[model samples]
Target: MTNPPSLLLVLSTCLHLLQWILDKLRITRLAQRILLHVLAAGPIPQHVAIVMDGNRRYARGKGKMVQEGHGDGYMALRRVLEICLRLNIQCVSVYAFAIDNFKRSPDEVDALMHLAENKLLELCSHGNLLQEYGVRLNVVGRLSLFPENVQVAVRKAEQLTKSNNRSILNVCMPYSSRDEMTTAVEGCIREALAEDDYFTESITEDTINSHLMSVQRGSPPVDILIRTSGVKRLSDFMLWQCCENTQLHFSKTYWPDFGLFDFVPIILEWQRSVWFRRHDVLFRS
Candidate 1:
């Protein structure tokens, strides 16, 4: 037999459970309709770029291997992509892997390469996802550096999504803003020489921009650059393209813990901020 005098304790426990259930139900409903009708009628951002950080830290904190963190981050990326699809964001760029990461320990590098290769394959092979979203896939990087299989998958994904127009998703693998800038400079030099024999010796910022990875590919300038894991720096991301007015949204949550639920709030906040800025500009103009 149980003690009958614990009436207050029973009531408190019951109330806590009821509150938790209500909160869960509320969040679920809210997620199903985060934007509702208002956002559907307003202007949405055309481009969003994200720097995914803190995978290793998350794994360490959870007493798991670092590679697991990458897997978690991959899941988070998928979630964000889905959110972008629903939100009608025209373009999204994710910093998948940096060239500097190649200098990591051999074992870790191998694991990461494997993960990236698998992810690329999945993106290419997931017919349902591709067909449903109509997302165009683009991978910006030194493709020669990737494994042969990864190269094949990247090409396949690009081909599969070539005609789609719902959104453009850019995955940056073994990529860096500085490297892109250098490449752009070289391209500008080559292009300018073709037009006139008396071409100048060097490239200006505007010329270089015309040759940039996104510019040549026809991507809008990044309206928002989100950095996860509480990091304050860009880590060589979009150094040339991200201008003075480009907004930054830094979240404390690890990439793996990030999902559509996390994306909605950031996007809403970004919309508000962009509106305010545009209003200010209009008034000043």
Candidate 2:
């Protein structure tokens, strides 16, 4: 009681705290509405692709190891998968490890490999919740480079959920869009030669796309590509397919900090944009 803050100081402090509380409440309400509407309207994405970024930066910010950030990212992904199921999303693709990531320090690369190995093993033993939801698991990208054990686990998970049709979850490991395109070209060349067609003449955009690694069984084109960590670059993920009016949602938050609730607002924003784009023909007038 001997000393009191100036009136201006006290008012400013109270105002700041009040504003913080209001912001938190508003965000909470928005998240709740987003979830409810997503479930009720079911305007879910046919295909959703994600670029998980910022693990190292997040770790640095928290004074933690990069490995810990990656571990946290893995757990966050599990939560998002559940959200995808609840939203009735038909296909979800996650960019796990890119071919360019191999350029990182040996210790970091080792940590990533270890994480993949452990996750694969766990998926093999426990299985995904996809079955109960009729979701199928698919692994895309260059799998020949993975360790023998990891490959086996990947194949096992794919086989276990091969017949399910509720949704498709595609995990891209060691993926490169250019490499994927080249591989598709190779496949087309083989198919053309098999039919006695000229390999040189048979390669076309459509031919190559037909052979690219994707949902062989009615996989929908990606409608939205979400990248975390404020990174504007696509990093060679779905490079050829995303050029035409595909919506992009960027988050400053690191991948590890993302959760089911965080995605709700993003989805809502995407939907609103889509609606406007679709009706722009009339609305612009």
Candidate 3:
């Protein structure tokens, strides 16, 4: 005959069960508001980045088409953005499409382009959700590669959201850190060469930083980066920006399955880290 589960075991089981429920049905808005109040009492990161991965895996796991997974991933972005707006996060960057994504099958790439165009246009319809939230949108990447019609939508979204000042959302499309860095370096070189008396001292870290895509997009350095789908790597993402003073959170849940409950706990952990760091508490202990 076995005894009843220990208190710790029972508590752990309950927490796990709660997480299962939260994954399916998110905690009510009132609970989210309480979490936000707690977050507001602590030091909040100025900038956040997310490497949204595993959309296709999520779709496959749910017995849906890969494109449907991407569609759901976009919906997840909307949810996260709403949370960010409520939290007053200053800047948020998301990996929308990487440069390497062009290597996907022609049909898939075309589908993505269509989806992007539709979404951008949708943002302009109705009362303009982004405008109402005062969230500025910046689409950063190699823009010339996009088809003409898609480019029109991109410009429209940026224009529509330009008047907002409350927060910034940067969507990186067909982007690669290597390409961004190379472009910045090239820009610096061209400027230095253009000036007859250019000195090596003038090309400082600040100058190069000013030329970075993030800077041009008006995003500060990343304070915290969260990657979903349980992946650990940055995958040629904002490498230089994330190199220093960035807290990395890797979630086991796929991007589509990830929700606010999964996010707030990670951020609470970040808040704790920030508190300890400010107090000079050695992490080793």
Worst 10 residues of 2 by lDDT: 2-11
Best by lDDT: 3
Backbone clash numbers for all candidates listed: 0, 0, 0
Pick by TM-score: which candidate is best?
3
**Candidate 2: count of backbone clashes, pairs at least 3 residues apart or interchain:** 0
Q: Model 1 residue 19 lDDT?
A: 41
Instruction: For residues 150-198, write the lDDT of model 3, one tens digit per residue.
Output: 8999998988888788888888987998999889988998999999647
TM-score of each: 0.84, 0.82, 0.87
Writing each residue's lDDT as its tens digit, candidate 1 over 1-285 gives 544335434544544454454336545645455543335455577889999999999999999999999998988888788777777888899999899988899999899878877787787575656568888888997778888877887888788788888778899888999999888877877777787645475566777788888767668888888999988899998877677767788888888887654565565656556555665576688
User: Candidate 3 has what TM-score?
Assistant: 0.87
Taking all chains together, the TM-score of candidate 1 against the true structure is 0.84
Please, what is the whole-model Cα lDDT of each candidate in the order they appear?
0.77, 0.76, 0.82
- Candidate 2's TM-score: 0.82
